[model samples]
Target chain A: MWYVKNALTRKNLMALTGLFLSFFLIIHLFGNLQLLLPEAEAKLQYNWYSDLLADNILIKIIAMVLYLCIILHTLDAIYLTVKSKKAKGSGYVKDRRGRASKWYSRNMMFLGSIVFLFLVIHFKDFWYQFKFGELPLDANGNKDLYTLVIKAFDQLWYVIVYIIAIIALGYHLLHGVFSAHRTLGLYHPLYSKIVKYLGMAYTIIMTIGYIIIPIFIYLNR
Target chain B: MKIHLKIWRQKDSQSKGEFKDYTLDDVHQELSFLEMLDTLNLKLVKKGEYPVEFDHDCREGICGQCGMMINGIAHGPLKNTTTCQLHMRSFKDGDTIYIEPFKAAAFPVVRDLKVNRSSLDHIITSGGYVSVDTGQAPEANSIPIAHEEAEAAFDAAACIGCGACVASCKNASAALFTSAKITQLELLPQGQTETSKRVISMVKQMEEEGFGHCTNTEACQVECPEDISVLNIARMNYEYNKAKILNK
Candidate 1:
């Protein structure tokens, strides 16, 4: 009840869930980087990695936490968004308030909605197919998720969707990462500056890393 | 110089507001923004028209009483300056300035260019002060505060409560104002006695006042007349988390 009632507590939940999701991006990118390998070795290695994650108890637990984080993050965002709409009493004529802050910083909710929509499409294409949809096995006898991923990216339109979604995610991280630190009370000036730059660098790397895969697969195919 | 004004006019909070147009010729560039408004009001009075109603006191920036959206910015285009301190020189001749009261659900317009800002006072009353005895003034040297701590406290204390932060914020969040109030006291030795209780009660009151949650867009810091750092918000979050966790 305290967490639900307190605005700061709700923000804390948002920050915690957002940071966790950010951390997950690094791991997700690393695993998916296997897709960059030569097709002969990539299929076997990627399938083995997927199978490893599917069978591991710890990965399963982490996956569950990841799912929960996504749900909670989305729900909190919706709650906060509705509250904010009511709080902003009226519209301004000849408005120029955008001069003060960065456009992405003010529009995080919009960027996040794009990312959320992409995730629904992303999970359906890869996660659902791997988990429940029947798929041909690879040389390693694991579900050929590598081939599935390749097939999706091989299409130009699908690749375009992936690129747009990743860019949206990049802008979301551009603000969300630094903002979460502030919300979590990282008040020291020096450490806050460090985190700010680190967030920027991390966002850039993750964006490029994720975007490169789809392009690489599409081009190579 | 000549200028065109589109100022918001509303009879009361219950009535619909609209932007009414007026033109002023022979305006002096050296006049303060409010002084220019005063000149405009004088002209209207001579014509038997109700002059535009705006809030101001002391005619100085410190009172925080003079606040409005000038060209869609809280206190005009000048950063870290109040409406009363802004001079007509900032605008070009024939510039069309749009003036509107600070808009927020918590701050209803009482009339043209004047909103009920008592919601801000409510946040302060919720516990923006220390609990001290009323007997006598304490010895000046009783508490030896570090210079850095004193300076930081002063910086936080500089908040003029102009409501500009809320006006500029897309969420209309009062985080900067509330946090500055909390941090100014939280930094000193005297305010430590009720730190936990003060933060909890004040934050609870802010929520009750219908302010949106802070998303850390940092617009508040940009528009703050005192240049209050967003770091104060981070400090407030820290103090709030500590209080909630320690449960003291």
Candidate 2:
């Protein structure tokens, strides 16, 4: 069936995976907020949360699904880019971009790549370290994932990288949140307006939440 | 009014094209956009130069034949106005107008401002109609439809296939055009039998024609001469999803 082969299917794949990852961000952000508690409480609570997540079979399954979503989303983006370039045939000789779309909307791939690269670095530093690298135990015997994160955010370059990444994520979501609904067929005008406003608020809140953690950690240190 | 024109000129589909400049000094503000071009062409003919080529059939905007990007905006600067409907008053004295063919892989340049929009026809060919025997035309009120539903269907039916939507889209996507057709048929009682089949094939054809995927930038709707809503695209996606799940 051309269902699998059609552009619409590919777009639906993008929207589905993108929205799933957006959900994951909410969960990820809520957990990371534990990093902002008072020093003693932050250490124990963050590590305990990390240990809980790492140990649970259900969370592990969800993590696996998250990884698959990332891979599929990235690959589909590449495929769509190539196909679109082909569809464009020849690039416009005189481009007038600002008249047509939001700057972030037109540059989604570039912003997404920045976020993807940051994700790789993020996972390598935090997730890989907590899972496989040597770690000290807190007094409660939980892995000292909190200290690892604090130490990582302590470095100026690390914090700057994070701020940049968070900004990229913000712009990515600016286009993505409403775009996902559009792709999935949210057509009503009034509802679309509501969704658009809600999307902006969500992107702002989520990005600021993620942004504050790194800056808060860096400044407090 | 005086105007400077940078019009794309090409020999044919295979030849390279470039913008050629001309100055029109004796132009009036009352002429339609196409009429101004006609004046320019007449001037070119007296000089033994080939007049610029463009597509037009019914100058009244319903035919969907006339379109070109005027100064980077499809169907010119006026919103929801076709090229024929756009008046020269939109321009001022000494205006520099840049005209180019609709840029899309599927719409290769035929010559000058005219590009082959047959890709759109191919999508329509794939499945844009209902199948019925031609014994006799059915009575208008034989199958009752709600007023709003019929109006919604008619709104979609207003698409003239001008390819301005394609021209205006950054991705060169034809989602609005294709969706308008699908919604037109899918909303009616007579179209119910082939609704599932029509969406699948037409969507497939649209993709195969090398149009890019729609990211819903909303540019197409803004630039569409008929004011065809981008909501039609959402309806199309819903119809395609419904067809995929239920048709099987």
TM-score of each candidate structure, all chains considered together: 0.98, 0.96
Candidate 2 has a DockQ of 0.67
lDDT of 1 by residue, A1-221 (tens): 22486678989999999999999999999999999999899999999999999999999999999999999999898888888999988868767889889899999989999999999998998999999999999776899998898888889999998999999999999999999999999999999999999999999999999999999898886
lDDT of 1 by residue, B21-132 (tens): 9999988999999999999999999999998999999787899999999988999989899999999999999899999999999899999999999999999999998888
Highest DockQ against the true fold, candidate: 1
Question: Ten consecutive residues with minimal summed lDDT in candidate 1 chain A?
Answer: A1-10
Worst 10 residues of 1 chain B by lDDT: B192-201
Best candidate (score: lDDT): 1
Deviation in Å, model 1, residue B59 alpha carbon = 1.3
Residue pairs in steric clash, candidate 2? none
Model 1: lDDT to the true structure: 0.93
Put down candidate 2 lDDT per residue, B26-74, tens digits, no spaces. Answer: 8999999999999999999999999988999899888999998888888
The digit string of per-residue lDDT tens for model 2 on A112-207 reads: 999999999988998899889999999999999898899999999999999999999999999998988988888887998899999999999999
Model 1 pairs whose backbones collide: none
